[model samples]
Target: MSSTPTDARLMDGSGLARRLVEETAARAADLTRRTGTPPCLATVLVGEDPASVTYVRMKRARCEKAGIRSRHVELPATTTTAEVVATLEGLSNDPEVHGILLQHPVGPGIDERAAFEAIAPEKDVDGVTFSSFATMSFGLPGFVSCTPGGIMRLLDAYGVDPAGKRAVVVGRSAILGKPAGMMLLARNATVTYCHSHTADLSAAVREADILVAAVGRPRFIKGEDIKPGAVVVDAGYNPGNVGDVDFDTAVTRAGLITPVPGGVGPMTIAVLLAQTVDAAERQLA
Candidate 1:
């Protein structure tokens, strides 16, 4: 027997990112013209974790494409937590650096939180600092975690209002999952958070009107568990460019879904560049 195909729309994050990047580039150009100093984003990384290196490289490439200046600092794998903190502190104090991003998951001995806290609030473009989280949670005007910010943008672009929706966020990482649920809550959505430890996880997922799969496990969220016509945002980026949701089956059930590579990845970088420009503008103001 043949299964009937469902009519689900694919969210084009890459297209949205391109448009946002163009706007950011224009703002960067205008900022440079007015202040004679281009917006600069400094990236700090500890160790040569392949993922971290790749992320920095992608960010740097995007920065140049958007007319934003970039400074990169890569520390040794043996770097201590204190050294990492000092490095971030130095970047935080640099006059030329409008935004500072300390790539996380430092060496095994490093305290990631301590390193994140070293970046000043005003310059925390990546939104890893507590100050940023506080403002974001309060719905105040401030920097946001880049990936979450991007996810919100995607929702808006598609006219998916969170108000009164049963939004379920899988995974509770500080930057992506936690901030996303908080932002949705600020928008009046009834939010539920689920992690690996969440009992009866599939049941919680099925109750969601808007599902954000961010567990970082490839195809961890089965398509059958997705509520019919629910909007799905797959935030996981596993190896082989796969997402947490099984798109093949999810596309048949969800009203809207984001594809793996062309979905959240580009938006994350786009959000970062936009925040960098925002930081520069605020500093000059």
Candidate 2:
């Protein structure tokens, strides 16, 4: 029933994320002052997928910038799932390590779920464990999946309350899509989850007052399908820095839309660093 009055306003995710990181930095400094131990985050990477290496490097850099400490463990591509689990379990038992992040898609053969479960729920700063999901789903106090947590923060920053909106999440990945829908639902949005198999995807998309596209495909959510005046969040980051929602077309129809590079991407790291600090403080306390 509603329509956009003009071209969609771009959501300033990078700006918001910068502010968030600054706040987290302050908290990190406080923790350091109080405990003589700077918040430490342990990042585990399997193999040297060029992309994963770059990501870990970036994360370490961010942790340093935020006044948090970083420890990295690199495992070979040939390492078995059992080895990965043992490594994670070791980190979990280490008192000095407050937060643990196991880089995703560990490799072709490793059992990612088993590796994730090896992390103690208290140190699950990456929010990969089942305990994290259960807590996130119920709006309880616990760590959240970073990307989804960032999405909620973005929504809050933009003053887009989800209390009565119709939210459609177009993906079902365990870390991103599923958690995102649960987040919106917890905020009282009427939530629908659509994936690669959804029938009449366009119809479902058009009905959304809030649209979250996390399908990791480049421009999969077309402009024509966007509902006018709807708030659009494109969480996809495929090659070429493209998002699931087509910015070119969707911008004209949406009231608010997130650009691929400066939008959800920056927020993801911001939330991760913030959560790392959170875990550290809790453990230190």
Candidate 3:
């Protein structure tokens, strides 16, 4: 029996992120006008890693464009875990700061989780804290990990409901994979997680109605693994602007697929700004 061919749709995350950023800018302006204080996002960078620096710079530029203020905290490469925690605690207590974002991979020596825990749950706009994870898992009203939150938003924009769908998340990192799975679970998707150690990764992926590739390895998910008509969300950002999934071939099979540069990257920052505004609004209330 010959199966009907599927014409895949490109999920335009860039377009959606643009609209979201515009809305966030307007809301930010309104909030500032009413409260006499602009929403402020505090960015904490542990080292001078070129990539991390660039990411923070981009975030600050976006905040400025959105009428939000930014407070930057730069630390030495050799900063200890306790020192990182102290800095975050300071930002957490600062009433002028509405949100806090700590750039990930704060070098090998530091205890990352301890530093993440230092940020107050209310100020954790990047949604890296355990509190945010729990809230997202339970479908509670709280900040969510920006990338996962953005993925959900994209799904909503494309009118793809996660309810009762099989979602296969490749990777189990705290910020990306784990949170993505939890968010899908909250939306009533039957979620499965696969990692480096999973046997038959391709088999797991082929079962997905919705596939989220966030394993951070370039072209790690092959096209043959993709189920026909599945919604594919590529959240990986590897070197040379490559995604975890092989987009070239996956696009042919996926009902909807997100491109690398224009997909999950833009949405991540858009969600951050939106959550920052939300944090400010809550503080004002």
Candidate 4:
């Protein structure tokens, strides 16, 4: 027996990121000519988590490509929370620094929330600050968490209007999963959030018109869980660059799906750059 192939449109985040970067670079050049001061993003990371290192490196490399300066601070693994906060505090006060991104998931014993709060709202380009989250929750114009921002952009690019849809987001991280649900809610989607404590993950996923898998466990969501014709956003950045949903089966069930590495990952950095430039524009004003 022959099976009919389903049409699941693949969302190309890498392609969109490239175009955004080109436009951003042009704007960065114009800004250089206007003020003779280039926009800079200060990246602070504690310890050497491989994933964090890769992410920070990617950010700096993208910044250079976009003509945005990057100042990197690699704190020693033994550094105390106070020292980390002090470093970020100093960067927050620097007028020359247009944006600040403290790479997520600091070492054990570090107060991540306290460190995030130390960043000036204007310079919190990564959108990890409480001020930023509050604004995002209320649908105000402020920096959004990069991964969530990217997911919204992806939805827009594909013409998947969230208005009146049943949107389900798995995971509740302050940065990725939580903000994504809030973004969908702001766009008029009825959002449901599920985490480790949820009783039935599959049931929650099936009710979604738009399902976002961001639980960080590779292949946690199976194809059987997806609602047919649902729009799937896989925002998981796990080991081996795999996503939370089982892509092979999900594509058969989904109307659209974002791939792991080239999907939300690229878009995250693109959003960061855009926000950084926006911060610079605000500072310039």
Candidate 5:
């Protein structure tokens, strides 16, 4: 028997992200002209993960182009959670620092969660703070997790309304999976949260009208499990920049699917910059 042909649409996050950055740049320039102080993002890196360094550099470069200033604080690999927290606390108290982004995966001995919590909710532009998480879950006004924010932006761009739709988020991490689920719920989606503990992963996925693959395991979600016509957001950044969903197969079943590397990754930074400017505006207000 022949397989059912795929009829999926592609969501282009990179293109949208580029547009967002352009808009953010304009906002930053306007703010600078009015307030005489450009928005500033303080980037805190605990270790020297080559990938993490590259991401931070990309963010800084983008900020420069946007007319925003960046204050970088790179700590040694041996920095402890206490030290990291102290540094974040200092940045939080600095009026000039409008936003703070503590890069993830500090080191083997470091407690990433504890370090993330050190950021004050007001300056937590990356949306890693407990306060940020609470606000996001409640659908209140607050900075959002970058990747999830980007996902929502893409959904809005594609005219995919989540209201009354069955959305399944396939991960539960604080930064990505959990926040993505909350964002969907806020948009009126009937969201089902699934993770490693889920007994029937495929069943859950198949029931989704909108499926988000953020489980990190590359190709963990099979195309056969995806419901036909479902919107798929693959937010995985695995080695080789592959997504959790098997794009080749999932695209066939999904109504709209995001491509790895070009999808959520670029959007993350765009949202970060936008949020940084927002934070600065809020500070002045």
Candidate 6:
């Protein structure tokens, strides 16, 4: 059957992110009004990867627009892992900083996990810390990884009930893939994770009612592997802004699909701002 436009809905992450950011800005203003302090996010970057620099700058710009304060800490390319961790720890201890974001791919030598763990759990608004992961896995009250949290928000906004659904998350990165599966599991979805080591990846993907492609390879998940009418969330942001799922073919098969540039990207920053506000509110209380 030839699929009509109504056969698949384009999940508008940009639109939803705009609404979320607006709400977050209002909350940030209200919090500042009540506490005499604006919610602050401290962004730490190790080494100057051009893409990481641009991403951090964008996040700070969003923070400014949302009425949140941003503190930037830039380290040299020669900085050691311990130095990076120490810098993050200092920011974590700063009372004025309600959120901490350590831009990923801090060069090749740095121990990324150790640095991520340096951020205090309460201020881990980017949700990279072990404590934050545990909390998110348990469905506890804690900040979640921005991308995964944003994905969940998109799901909710579109009225995609995950309860009893079979969800396949393609990738196992701590921040994006693993957390995404955990979030879906929390919502009562039977979740399966597929990574580079997973055998028969296509077989797993074919079983999913909901599929999240976060493997970071452009057009890695083919349309033939997608279950018809599946909810497809493409969270990959590779060079040229291409997504993991082959969008042109997958769109015809999916019941709903998120576009590459207009989809998961915007929601990530929106979730960060919202969580920063939430952290600030909790700290004030």
What lDDT does the true structure give each of the candidates?
A: 0.93, 0.93, 0.94, 0.91, 0.90, 0.93
Instruction: List ranges where model 6 is wrong by over 4 Å.
Output: 1-6
All candidates: TM-score: 0.97, 0.97, 0.97, 0.97, 0.96, 0.97
Q: Judged by TM-score relative to the true structure, which candidate is superior, 1 or 5?
A: 1
Alpha-carbon shift of residue 250 in model 1 (angstroms): 0.8
Q: Is candidate 4 or candidate 5 better by lDDT?
A: 4
lDDT of 3 by residue, 1-285 (tens): 123245888888899999999999999999999989999999999989999999999999999999999999999999999999999999999999999999989999899999999999999999999999999888898999999999999999999999999999999999999999998998899999999999989899999999999998999999888999899999998998889988888887999999888999999999999999999999987
In candidate 4, what are the lDDT values of residues 1-285, reduced to their tens digit?
113267988899999999989888988888888998999999998999998898799899999999999999999888888998999999988999999999878989799899999899999899998999999998787899998999999999999999999999999999988999999999999999999999988899999999988898999999999999999999997777688988888889999988877898899899899899999988987
- lDDT per residue for candidate 5 within 160-215, as digits (tens), equals 99999999999999899999999898889999999999998999999999988888
Model 2 misplacement above 4 A: 1-6
Candidate 6 clash pair list: none
Give candidate 1 misplaced runs (Cα > 4 Å): 1-5
lDDT of 2 by residue, 1-285 (tens): 124446688888999999999999999999999999999999999999999999999999999999999999999999999999999999999999999999998988999999999999999998999999999998899999999999999999889999999999999999999999999999999999999999999999999999999988899999899998999999999998889988888888899998878999999999999999999888899
Ten contiguous residues with the weakest lDDT in model 5: 1-10
lDDT of 1 at 16: 100
